[model samples]
Target chain A: MLDQKAHKPHERLAAHLKDDLSQVDEMIRARMASEHAPRIPEVTAHLVDAGGKRLRPMLTLASARLCGYEGGHHIHLATAVEFIHTATLLHDDVVDESGQRRGRPTANLLWDNKSSVLVGDYLFARSFQLMTEADSLRVLQVLSNASATITEGEVLQLTAAQDLGTTEDTYFKVVRGKTAALFAAATEVGGILAGVSEDRIKALHDYGDALGIAFQVVDDLLDFWGGDATGKNIGDDFRERKLTLPIIKAIARGDDEERAFWKRTLEKNDQRDGDLERALEIMTAHGALDDTRAAALDWAARAKACLDALPEDPIRDMLSDIADYVVARLN
Target chain B: MLDQKAHKPHERLAAHLKDDLSQVDEMIRARMASEHAPRIPEVTAHLVDAGGKRLRPMLTLASARLCGYEGGHHIHLATAVEFIHTATLLHDDVVDESGQRRGRPTANLLWDNKSSVLVGDYLFARSFQLMTEADSLRVLQVLSNASATITEGEVLQLTAAQDLGTTEDTYFKVVRGKTAALFAAATEVGGILAGVSEDRIKALHDYGDALGIAFQVVDDLLDFWGGDATGKNIGDDFRERKLTLPIIKAIARGDDEERAFWKRTLEKNDQRDGDLERALEIMTAHGALDDTRAAALDWAARAKACLDALPEDPIRDMLSDIADYVVARLN
Candidate 1:
């Protein structure tokens, strides 16, 4: 087993890529500024400088380094990925009416929804401009297509919310759209910029996709797992009526009474004081939480396996550890 | 003089490029479809089919045709431009909390702000994808830069709204961002796709920029010009407290009393019934309205002058006539 007391995978990766990460920070700061509208920078800086781990951009940097890339465009792609992420966070907070994000007041709350909306748009446009500067049509295609998928996923999540008919298939689609698309694109573009072979690029894409899925599944799991150290409260997703994986699994295996319970709590948004405990009891009784945990582990394993196709570099090892580290919170 | 009864310039352009326009329509319908999210197409179709003149896309088509070039990619660029416009309209309604657009209930009003915001994002991403299909880095740069400028302008407008300190320079920047950036990009990309020379491209760019400026100036003027055939009501800008061209001019020319009225009406947004009339009277008394009209005419003339650089074709004549038609309402 790895030394858990040692530096975390992302921290080690950040150390190794210290220069590149700093360059990315520089690029993000430079690009987010607006000559005409100071609000663009204000709203963007609030989110971009929020203490969230720069995991996505790190993935790009790590992937490019692992693929033997020595060029600077990876920095551009990494900054672009972060910009897209920041933009989406701004918009998502508005959509979810979220007051806080990354333990800070969201841009939507700090400013108004209008600032969040318009500033999100500005960042998106900025991202588009940055990606085009990469000057690779393939890179443009990968990023642009991922962007479409991400937005499509958000829309699907919106429509699928509070609907008990949301299948596991639809759940995966939403997860892919909301989380995995950019992750995959982030890694895939790194490989592309490195002039790596198609197979290697595919492997990187698969690795990022699996890693993202595992990351989100753990996130959803932790939301209900309660009392974990992730700073998320128990049953927050439940309060929001989000139809996540465990609930979807529970709904599928639920007895008539259990299904009715879900319907009342989720579909109808009618929850009594004891409903959270009862819902957890039902989920545990049906092994739904266990199954969700298993699915997350499987994805994490798949992510690690995809890394084997890359060269045996320290970066690759860190990437594998990152996958494990994502699901390790469950332990 | 041409027979005004025969057809509007846009109508003539539309008739001339009916096949291209229809192809653009087909592409828009096809591309706007979301395999998972039906709401995307539903919201998109509502705006796309709202029977507003497809003026921007037609500019793209006419520019390409006038450049003596033939290609299918122009259709893609045109559709991409339209998608950008539609996406902006969606977000604008949400930002403005508007209930109506193009004489139809807005997507934000019909569905919700969430739908409008997410669907608009989806359309923006879709536009990004379509523009990449044109397979030119330069095209990507142009469209992406325009997208950035457009969003920047919007954020500026959001911040600049109701501020009496907004200058003519700031007003033009806002106008470029909100309206003219896409217009210039649309026409510029047509010449780009035609593989035209640098001077021709510059001419196309200038023509589009001036035309867009004129188009928006006329739009702003009409919002307060009060009673023409256009469906817009007078003083909409005043009611919204938006700082448009005429108001900027009027504010610059206003004395201390006039400034107080504007500060009360626009800055503080406190108004009784006659405030709109008083605002108009102040504007007319200062010749702000007339100067605004003259400015619009200057831009229209500039747009027509730019057309002189391109080869003489039926489309060229139509474009010049279109410029004239844009400001013809002032007569």
Candidate 2:
């Protein structure tokens, strides 16, 4: 895994897809600008320039290229993907009451919550406009469904955030809604834009879905085990009383006394000193972290397998490698 | 204008379009449901069942009906319009930190800000899904642009909320962005769905724009002069330091002393005992209320004029009458 870190799968993909990625970036910059509302560009520029991995849009581009798409609509779809991602990030920060994103202050923190909420909405609409310009009904259907699923996932998470009774089924549903849906759509739209076969489209969808799930699982795992490099505070999810996969797994195996601890810290949000440490100890004792890591690896493997249906190309290989990279960080 | 109140233009329109409107309502109910997220239906039903006038969606139905649209997609478009309107209300209540809507507890207050924000986003995405299902590229373009305009208007209003420097031009821009953008789109999409002439589409767009502007102006006026029936507390905008049409008019004609008062009350958010009453006094002295009322009536007249391009029909007549009805309450 340490050796894998030096490979930088995303960097390799970005290098191979540099032209399309640059066009996507340019489209993003141009579309985010508003003639009447100057604040929109300002707010959007802050988040857009914050040095994110741009993985979702890159996935769209890579999938398009792999499907032998020579047309220009892929760039619009890629840009729309990025816009959707950025818009969700803006609203997610507000909903999560977050202060930082990608090692910088959040839009909600820099601007007001009102600005974050409204601008997120503006971006969502702008994304729709971009996709419409692509003139693909199938692409529009995929992206719109993804948007709805993403919001539904977030809302489901709201209801399930701190409930100790949340099941693995609900967790997967939430993950699919919040993370996998957009990823799935991002890739599926790429195949649709390429006018690829239905089988290839479904393969791309499955790849993105599994990759996103692995990505989110690793993210939740990092909340307990990763460092400041993640741009999120270690254990922030625990403090916020979010019942992500790690805790949800731990709660399943806990005894009555341990269950009460979760009830106090998560459901009731009544925390004391050393609660995070105690919770980590409980998860370690129950092998929840190890199980969660295993689950991520399984998803990553599934993601890589989905890429097998696509044609053999450098971009396809890189897409496969990125799935490995998503889970590799956990190792 | 006073005589127009007796006609009950909206009720007549509703009665005429009852079948379509009911179908739209049914579609809305069907689309708002989430299998995994029951909270979505619960929160949406609260606002949807609040006895709102259904004015925006009714406009879509009426416009489509008047244009001889025999297709069924109008139900989808109309529902999309209502979902957009309701989603905005959910987020607006959160942005305004309001406690009540339609004489009941707001979604934010009843559930939470998180629910309100997330559910609003869900509804927004759902609306897009509904419009996409309607299968009109033109409809998608109009609605997406309108969505962006709605958000941009809200963001601009956020930036301009309490500022004394907000001009009538800016007010109109904000009004168009927030309220009228959806209105314009609702009517334009109806015409587009009907496959009407471009000239007729423009007429519908203009009609909705003026009607929306008039509607908002009257609502703003009601915030000051109207009684309890408007479902908003009198001087709520004044207390919140909002720069609506009346305040913008008063500020334009205000003298230095009045300017100082505005700066202290609005910009600085420093209030003394009797600020709302004094603000009303200043607006009265400047004849700001009268001018504002005149502007609303002018927009209403302009709205009615745009309907002349459409063929003679009961729906078209009702639409024209509704334009008159929007500002008639001011009498």
Candidate 3:
């Protein structure tokens, strides 16, 4: 994990999404600045300019292009999907009472919770408008379905917080609803708008869903085990009392004493200094991190395999590479 | 202002939206309950079962039916629109820090703000899912645009809360975004789904817009002149420091001293008992209330007039009667 090597993973990933990523970026900049409600430009620009990896929109763009979508509406569909994703993130911070995001002060922290909520809402609405421009009922259907899944996912996560009994089944449901649903929809609509066959659409959807699951799984894993000082904040998930996969695995493997320790720390969200060390010791002793990484790799492999049914193209090749790149950086 | 007379007006309004209203009630009850999240059902039921006049959804249904729509999707569209509106109200009460809604405790009052916000988001998602079932690009456009407008309207209201210089134009814009946009979309979608002529669809849209404007205008007037001990609190608007039409008009007509008094009380959003009385007196002296009433009547007239272009039928006739009834109850 040298500094240069540490950045190699992101660079390699960017190389895969290169062209479609650029298109999604350009479309996002164009669509984010609507003429109505001058405030839209101001509020949207604040977050949009902050620079995201554009990972979700790229999935959509690549998916559609890979499926032979020569039409431009896919651009609109891609950007719309991204906006919906971003809007949810904004409102989520406020609801979670979170103060930081992507290593910066959150929108709620900078202004107030009210602005974050309303602006998040505005962005959501704007995304809908973007989808409307696609002029395909099926495309709208795909995107709105994703939007609903995203919201329901968030609600499940909210209600599930700090509840130790949150099972692996529910965790997957929450992750699918909150994250993978949009990823799948974004790519699925791309194929759909291209008027691709149902099989290809399903293939792209499976690819995106598996990739998203892998992405989130890796994120959860890093929060617990990424050893570099960079992502060493493994204790926040326990501190927040979130029911992540590693913790679920650990709990399932716990003895009576270990179970009591988990209840006192993660379930109660009260951790002492020695708790992280203790938790890490128990996780390694129980092979939790190893199991979690293996699961992420499994999802990533499934994602790559889903692309096998699609027609061959540079875009398809890149999407397969992107799938591998999703969890490649995970130790 | 008596409970007996209040029922007369409410019953008239309710009957106007009767068929559509009942359908919305059934749809709402069915959708809010899901097997996966029992808690979601409980939280949602608290808000949904606590009935407010289902005016917004009824507008969608009545408008669709009035526009001669024959499709089944409109039902889902109407209900989806309503779920979104309810979700916003749940969030709004939390933001506004209000305690009462429809003569009962607000959602935020009953539960914590956290529950209100998260549950509100869940309903928003459910609404999106319902509308996506319509599978119409045009329908998605109308609904998504309305969603964005609603958010922008709310934010405008938030920023403009106590600004004494709030213009009639801004007020109208806010009201349109907040209320009329959805109303217009509700009816407009009916014509779109019915495969009607574009001009007829536009006419339906205009009809809904005028009716919604009139509805909101009358609402503001009632807030000022309607007495307490019945019909909810009259001075709540004044107390909240909201700059509604009557006050905005009165401010325009004020002398220098009167202007300063507004700056202190209205802008400050703090007023003694005398201040409300004095503000009412000033508004009356300048005929602002009458001016507002006249404007509302004009809108109602325009709304009824839009029906002339519609095909002659009993439904159309009832719609015309409904428009008249919206403002007639004010008198």
Candidate order by decreasing DockQ: 1, 2, 3
Model 2 CAPRI quality: medium
* The best candidate in terms of DockQ: 1
Residue-wise lDDT of candidate 1 within B150-181, one digit each (tens)?
A: 98998898888889999999999998988889
Instruction: Give the alpha-carbon lDDT of every model.
Output: 0.89, 0.89, 0.77
Prediction 1 global C-alpha lDDT? 0.89
The candidate that achieves the highest TM-score relative to the unseen native structure:
1
* Tens digit per residue, CA lDDT, model 3, A1-331: 1234434444444565566567777877776664445666677777787767777777777777777778888778778887888788777767667422323344345346677677777777777788778877677667766776666677787778778798999999888988899889988988898888899899989988998899888888888777453344756776777888998999999999999999889666577889988988998899999999999999999998998889988667767776777787674
Model 3 chain B weakest lDDT span, ten residues long: B1-10
What is the per-residue lDDT of model 2 for residues A1-331, given as tens digits with 9 covering 90 to 100? 1223345989888887877888888899999998778899999999999859899999899888999999999899989989989989988887777888999999877777777878888999999999899998889989989988998888888888778889888999999999999999999998998888999999999999999999998998999987565888888999988888889889999899999999999988899999999999999999999999999999999999998899999888889889988888976
* Every candidate's chain B TM-score: 0.94, 0.93, 0.91
As a whole number from 0 to 100, the lDDT of residue B248 in candidate 1 is: 92
Candidate 1 stretches greater than 4 Å from native: A1-6, A227-230, B1-6, B98-111, B227-230
How far out, in Å, is residue B306 in model 3? Answer: 1.6
Q: Worst lDDT window (10 residues) for model 2 chain B? A: B98-107
Instruction: Report per-prediction Cα RMSD to one decimal.
Output: 3.1, 3.6, 4.5
Candidate 1 matches the true fold with a TM-score of 0.96
Q: DockQ of each model against the real complex?
A: 0.74, 0.66, 0.49
